[model samples]
Target: MDKSYDPFKYSSDSLEDVAEQISDVLKCPITIEDVNHRLLAYSTHSDSTDPARISTIIGRRVPEKVIHSLWKDGTIPALLKSQEPIHVKNIKEVGLGNRVAISIWKNNEVLGFIWAQEINKSLTSNELDLLKKAANAVQNKLLYLQKGKMKKEEREQEFFWKLLTGNTLRHDDMADGFYQLNKTMPPIYSVVLFRFTKPITEKMEKQLNYLLETTQLVHICLVTIDYNELILLVSPKEEQPLNQIKQFLRVMEKQMMQRYNIEHFAMSIGGIYSDISSVHIAYKEALAVLKVKERYLSDAEHLMSFSELGIYQYLDVLAEKRKHNRSPNYPLSQLEKYDNEHHSNLIETLETFIDSDSNVKTAAKQLNVHVNTLNYRLKRIQEITGLDLKNVNEKFSILLEIKIRNMGL
Candidate 1:
């Protein structure tokens, strides 16, 4: 081995060339990935390649489970923290073989990683130094690719915002932007929003972009950041879009919480639309669902769409009317006062009754109380408020007022 060897001095004009060069020097299989585990390049390999490498190359990105395993085992974290090569023993459970990897870095940030599978030999200290050299050689090429990607991303963001804000009236009008970007609009899409408690950091953005780009389960048409919110235009490929979105949300929520210890973000989606022109409505609806979750966090916890809000969907309109008329909810106020003074739960019983669709048995079961107990409470409720329990209008009004009071509006 040359003592003063330089990666740049080798015959390499592209990342693929760098990969093949590294593989030739190390006599092993080689693969390269961006910071998000999306495969960028790999060297021609023999039959000695492991299942993990085969999966990554086939999918053109690392599988989620493999990525999860690497993160959980502390290998990925260590690689991110240093430019030095990390020797990883085979994690047979995740189909990983013995390998050595190093992060490609430009400055303080990691641009990507290069992996050399040790099929038959372990890398000596000098070879470890050689792997580090490979990382250095791969850096500038990755940066050039990244610069082009970022500019395309910026244009997509601009065009998306214009569509969302209703600047582009029809799909036909966006033909030029679509052609210039070399992207196709989804035939069907929904506006999905994730609200974070704090503004997203650059690291978090990279993680999110990685997830969206690498995952095939959910089709993300476009994504952008607005303050503390990460907005995505999701294209559900399944025949039933709602089920697809629900599954996507479950997976994303689990991933964000598990991988990043991120639990502060909540996900919501608007009605699925067939045309881009309806996206403004979808955007508004998504924002509405977000507001519902903000005001009634516990009650709206599982509700991801506007329709799921049920009677609470009219909270904004009700609130608007109250501002003008200022009519106090007399019956609900009386019940709340009685419950407070008696150390009772008359208010809960009433709300539970309404939520159970006025079913005494269901309401009693939900409250973990006896049917007679719930009935007696109902009798007492009617007595205190002098309110008719059979009135549909009255029942809805009570539930609406309770939700409003719960929101402190």
Candidate 2:
């Protein structure tokens, strides 16, 4: 070890530069790797390198064989449990020479590892002390990087929140914000709203983050609206946007249920919009779908999409209009009056008929009534509403009226 070498003097240097300085001071080759075994940096000196180190450096990942060997020898477990530097002699069985390694820690969290290889001779106590100092330097570097990353993510999350809530509307400003975050605004985007039956746990949040990071979608932005609601904005990397969105939702739903043990949840997806500035339009649609699911489709278990809302979507629109005294022209009120007077389910029967694809037998089975009884009720509904069941326009009008009535419009 160089007695006069000050590890602090190289504080401003890059990880690779720090590794080089450490290698020179310790008289051995050095490598820095993240917790996932991804190579971060390595010394240039390679006089006595092994195939494993060379391959790891070239691939930027430690190979599975080396990882398995390290695990089998209990080196990985020891490294993870220890804050002090560890010396491994005769690593030749694992296709490597003697080496010293230490886990980089910040606040007791293992961030990465520093490895010093002993090529020509064994590392002495002084060299081990120098390696430990290098580990501390790596720890500081990781801390700085982690803090920088967290700050960047915070800014991005804030931007996403504002954009989704309609606070930031200008196209140029939105684009600039994305640029600052080093993210590209996708040409087409959609929003998905998730509602949990219970408050989210820290483990659930970590799982959500992992899911988002591993998903195939491009340009994803996830933000928690509250303890029970989460919003995701994403663009499909594939060509079939709608299909891809559905597939993604299905996978997420299954994973949440099976992996996280979440039994009850709902996911609502919005229509895709082509312009980035219109993301709030999608956001609003997603919220509407969630509201519609909770109020109208309570039996719907996991997934709902804006496109699947059908007449209910128009009902929501009509609802807004009705609030302003522009009520929709539907004659379901006459049926409602008749049903209330007769204590009948005429409106439900009509809805079941439509929902069953106009199949009388299927509608009868769904309503748990005989075919003749369902036929008689349909005839009564037609007579009361003056709608012909055989007429397409009349059937559609009845369906729309039923939807409006269901929405209490």
Candidate 3:
């Protein structure tokens, strides 16, 4: 080991220099890579480099084939689990010679890797010890970088949360915050809210974060508002913003289902609003859409948009009006009262009947009841409400009334 080697002296600016120093002390070329195998830094010595290392540097990532080969040989897994340097005697089949690799770690988490190619001779114990010191230096550098990044993300998330929650009012303030985050104030943005049946797991959250980072959208911000919900704000770069969002959401749904086995989830997208200050409007619209989905479109698995909500978009307005004004009691409320008094489910029967498009046989089949029993129930409903089932207008009005009541308005 080099008595003068000091891991504490390196900073972000000196990462490449540290790699060069390690290379000089160990008499081997060095390559530094993130856990994903993306190249971070490498020594300048090129004379003794192998084809794999050269390809990794050129491509900025380790080739998939090389990674697969390493996985098959259990080398990648071993390095991931251990902080000690691992020596590969030979990997000529994958266009590499002998090399020693150490996991750059912090708090038991493997952050990256530092690899030293053993070109002319195997690394001695002393050289391996020096490599460990280099790995510790890289770990410290990564920790510093990660902390800085986390602070920036925290600030951005706070700004985004404030924007969504309508805490920040002035456009200039928002613009300044966006500028601090290195983001522009989007002219128009839409919010998408995800609701999960269960709280998201750490693995699920990590996968979602990775997906958000890798998504092809040009401008986006994702934040978790609750344990079971995630909010995504997107500013589309294309002419058709709605279409772009829908397509991105579809891809996300498929990946979530296929990759993560996430079966019970729903997503609602709000209408696009032009001004940053009006983003809360979009957020409310998204919440409304989610409510509509839960009440009316519970069976739908794809993303629901505010524009597609039809008459239900105005339900929230009606609900508020109903709150302040004394409106006529909904006719469906009469049936609900009767059902509760009698311990019956005439409301469910009526809903199933309407949902089946007024087909008595279909409704009966859906309800798992005999058609005559369904007819008797329909007759009783008409008798109780004095509404004629044969009249189209009456049926339509009843259906609308039932929908509004189902929304708990």
- Top-lDDT candidate index: 1
Query: lDDT tens digits, residues 62-111, model 1?
Result: 98788878888999889889889998989999889999999999989899
lDDT of 3 by residue, 1-409 (tens): 4677664355345778878888887888999887667777899866667889888888887775677577667787798678889987677788977888999988867778998988778988878888888887788777777688679878877888888899999989988888888886787789988899989887677668645654555356646556898788888864888888887788778767755578778888898877888878899999988887787665333438988876676766766776787665566768988999999999789879876889999999999999999999999998888878888888877776666677667
Q: Order candidates by TM-score, high to low.
A: 1, 2, 3
Model 1 residue runs over 4 Å out of place are: 322-343, 359-362, 365-368, 382-394
**For model 1, what is the C-alpha lDDT against the true structure?**
0.86
Task: Looking at model 3, report the run of 10 residues with the lowest lDDT sum.
Answer: 294-303
- Better candidate by lDDT, 1 or 3: 1
Cα error, candidate 2, residue 191 (Å): 1.9
Ranking, lDDT, top scorer first: 1, 3, 2
Give the higher-TM-score candidate: 2 or 3: 2
lDDT (Cα) of model 2: 0.77
Candidates' TM-scores? 0.89, 0.62, 0.59
Position 353, candidate 2: lDDT: 94
